[model samples]
Target: MQSDADGRLTPGGGTDALFWGSLFRDLDREGSFLQLQIRQIIVSAIENGRLPLGARMPSSRDLAAVLKVSRNTIVIAYEQLIDQNFLIARERTGYFVAGLPKHIGAAAREPGGATRDDGRWTSRFAHRPSTYRNIVKPLDWQAHPYPFIFGQFDPGLFPTNDWRESARAALSVPEINNWARDLIDGDDPALIEQLQLQVLPRRGIRARSDEIMITIGAQHALYLIAKLFITPTTRIGVEEPGYPDARNIFGLLTPNVVPLRVDSGGLVLGDEFENCSLVHVTASHQCPTAVVMPLARRHALLQAAQSHGIILIEDDYDGELMPEEGELPPLMSLDRGSSVLYVGSLSKALAPGLRLGYVVAPAPVIRELRALRRLMLRHPPLNNQRVAALFIGLGHYRSHLARVGSVLLERARILDRLLPQHLPHCTWSRGAGSTHYWVSCRPGTDTVKLAELARAQGVVIEPGDVFSIDEGSARHCFRLGFSSIRTERIEAGVERLGKVITQTG
Candidate 1:
């Protein structure tokens, strides 16, 4: 069966019934009635080589007409295939068959009318060791509006000329030849000194050159810390609705990942830490919720860590991106007990592509982390670190930050105004000082559906589910990032997203 010029399926060639009827039989075995039928047909076609790998499928409307079904059915079928990895959809070019399955062909068919469970039998990943990939799906950013994509800087506003100059200068350095073998646990002393002088003071963190270790980025830093501190059964307290990457890292290293609740002030520390040996916190600006840990709570956290002999991994990932309010003291600044391990990154302030971050810990822990880092990637690339240090030491870094900060403030203002107009039912909370806003929608609203609708309108928003520890309460909130896109885009994006919510309601 093929589609005619008018976009209707015509049963033309011989064996048309055999081709079409086989699809129907397969659909009968599939549970879902409407879309599943279309999906089954597509899957069978791909499996049988009728639609080869990378072959474009008919448009949804044309296929719907051919199959005597509604366009909605075809759309849902296509969406299912896209979700299940059975097909790949190009934005405007329709769907194409994905790579061929390893099984489910003539080889799996029994001549005596017996059928084998080809999918189950031929799976190569069945016994693979458990890893983070199984728990986390690559976030689909295209499906929401104002998605607070973590760790992305405002690319349009970045100081490209300044960066180019610094990079070129660094490449031209006579000592650059040593960079090939300089990939090790410690970074350049000049870079470490620059971090100690330029970055730590703003957050009230005091560290010497010997205490800081450079890593690829905050994620890499967190991974190395987890490897060093977390044992298989160690109970690590993580903030509920926290950074997923942090939680995922700790989860992979240790089975006992404790979820600590948070409120307006910050982490609600109770007796949960009695048995917990380690804690990971985004103290500067809490991820997703964007709450800055209050000074009292910071002290309480520090006291708890000291009293319990626990380690505190303070991830100041986006500290510098915090809007200009009086500087909020980092945990390390107030940490008199030498228990806080402070990790900061330039990824958010500069650009994530740089992949440069540093961790300041006690001399002992720093030594252990360095050993672990050697086991991991040996060290981060030295050239970026040297150039970044040069940029900061020469004052170019601060200038770039000032420019980006101004743009972020303007964008944040635009978002604050536009959000209320577009989403009247939602309320926005400003953090102590951060790049994004935490938006709480009206109770009983489905943020997942809201995300879907926004996605349909070309706005990528981050749903609250990724941040929630209990998953059940994540549907009423979402995060909006104002630092990455242009200020003008914020208004239009919010307006378009608002239309989705209004129409859905």
Candidate 2:
């Protein structure tokens, strides 16, 4: 049946009957099973775009009546289709075409489904984004014997039961009523409340609902901030050996991207920072370097930002995965005038695929973000927000963090003992309360070569070149993570990796 303008299919007697008839006509009557043939036909129709997106299908009873088949057969076929991505079943709206990819369920209707509308369309664009060259990991990273990749969670340690429980709680009728619909503010109020109550307190931050905004993740939060604050005329400062992703975001917005030098103490805040309109600093557990900015320096940075009227963007990378001791409070807690905007993520702590993070800023900034968010995605899936909130309210968030802390500390100790013994000539950074170790190699020992050699030996590690912009991807340094690697494999992984480092050195 053809759909109305709203994509609602109406049971137009002749057309609807004939449409199903044509679809079923091609079905193999001599096939081993009748239901399987019908399922294949429907799958083919969806993939070929014969049944367009959101074009509703007839009711099971109606389709069955038209096709001269038992309702049970049609029902089973539809359920299987829904299980796959070929179709989607709305709660009350009935079955609909899910807009599955052209490659699935059927052979191509024709080569390259849609031809070009306008020739050579590359001539126009609002702003061309910067090319982000991330540290490339193999697609089969999981199958590898050793993986020392950073900012990942060990799947074994994931709070599966706890997360499932929280999800169940969120899915209940009362909680479903809370987050099932869209919000004007583009964030779950319960989530904001939980963040204010549970997550931020550990960082020593106290923020009102007006001052907080839940984003798709920290990456999205950075994009919103850059979109609002950065312009061609604005001078923005980022750590020299900073996050390449953040640098890429700012690069897309403005050409005046200043790479600020970072010493062992963290972003070298001085007269250099005073000239910029906004500065992005990862003070707590500096990216790649893993250096925690000293409390004295944190105060000085706030003083500088306050004095110069420079807004600071602090990406609290891995700030939540701190070990048993030696961790500093977030800079946001110390910002009396609210000059700092803090970005925190669940990706590091919980799971990267979850794509949940939040931004803590002044009330005015959050208000602007709400409008921007409404325009772009209308608030990350409320279901995820609700699940995260329930996770926090149930005390799983803290307990999960504690579990991760213990796991990481033991891994860190494993690396500490093995790295020095294996690669005796190399020196490394001893940054505390982080998941990875930022190792500095000998003067000419390019860690990139070492990383490649290590990979060949069935070990995976990150080369520290992408971390630096000024010195062309710092060749002498590399980041080694234990977050995803198993404790048992830690020794062998480092042993093989250290042999590569020593041989290359």
User: lDDT of each structure?
Assistant: 0.75, 0.83
Residue 85, model 1: Cα distance from true site in angstroms: 40
Model 1 lDDT per residue over 357-471, tens place: 8889988878898889888777888888778877888888788777777777787767767777898977766675688777888788777787767777877666787686677
Superposed model 2: Cα runs more than 4 Å off: 1-119, 125-130, 471-473
| Clashes in predicted model 1 | 7
Per-residue lDDT of candidate 2, residues 87-117 (tens digit): 8888886888887554553445665546674
**Which candidate leads in lDDT?**
2
lDDT of 1 at 415: 73
RMSD of candidate 1 to the truth, in angstroms, is 12.7
Itemize residue pairs with steric clashes in candidate 1.
Answer: 144-459, 144-460, 144-461, 145-459, 145-460, 145-461, 241-467
Model 2 lDDT at residue 229 = 91
